[model samples]
Target: MDLAWVRQHVRQAAAELGFGLVDQTKLVTAASELARNTLVHGGGGQVESTVLQNGLARGLRLTFTDEGPGIPDIERALSDGYTSGGGLGLGLGGARRLVHEFSLDSRPGAGTAVTVICWVAGPPRQRKEMR
Candidate 1:
């Protein structure tokens, strides 16, 4: 998959979905890290985005899934700067910091799935009537 295009698409989608500048930046950064992990470690994966609705509230959810060699130690993988390869190891941990909610599920030889959910910060409200 085209990582740059994926990141750009995420940025555009976030903007169109009414996420603020800071939120959009965070989403883009998270997408980058997740996409790289999917490519380098997971061998291949998919990223999906959906609009989230909680009653009168609205938000966005992003899921990244992979079917490659699973992580052997999730805790170590999540530790900052803990990479097996000689590469910077900020992908998963940094991603966790960038979202309101983050979850990961994986086991050795069982693949991995990462889900992140972030809301726009408030419920939608209609304008008050003018006197």
Candidate 2:
């Protein structure tokens, strides 16, 4: 997966959801890290974005999935300094910290999927209703 494309897509979604610059940066940064993990560790994956709403709240949700040797130990993977690959081992944990909501599912012989959401506090922008 192209990390740049993932970042851009996340930034666009955040902006559309009325997330400020800080929130946009957070979302993009998290997306970049996850996308990289999806490629290097998960053996490549696809990302999907969605505009979310909860009453007056607005948010952007990003989901990354890959069909590869899934994480053997999810708890260790989410630890701050653990890695299956060569790196600082902060991708999953750091990405989780940057978003309002985060979830992960992995089947050792199947694949892995990570989902994250960043929200804009307060009311949403005045626009057509999201479907």
Candidate maximizing lDDT? 2
For candidate 1, the C-alpha RMSD (Å) to the true structure equals 4.8
Give the per-residue lDDT digits (tens) of candidate 1, residues 1-38.
Answer: 47897789888877766787898899888888888888
lDDT of 2 by residue, 1-131 (tens): 37777787788777767788888988888888888888888889899888888888888888999998998999988988766666435668888998989999998979999999877877655556789
Q: What's every prediction's RMSD, in angstroms?
A: 4.8, 4.9
Which residue pairs clash in candidate 1? none
Return the lDDT, model 2, position 8: 79
Candidate 1: segments with Cα more than 4 A from true spot: 84-89, 122-131
Error of 2 at 57 (Å): 0.6
Candidate 1, residue 28: lDDT = 85
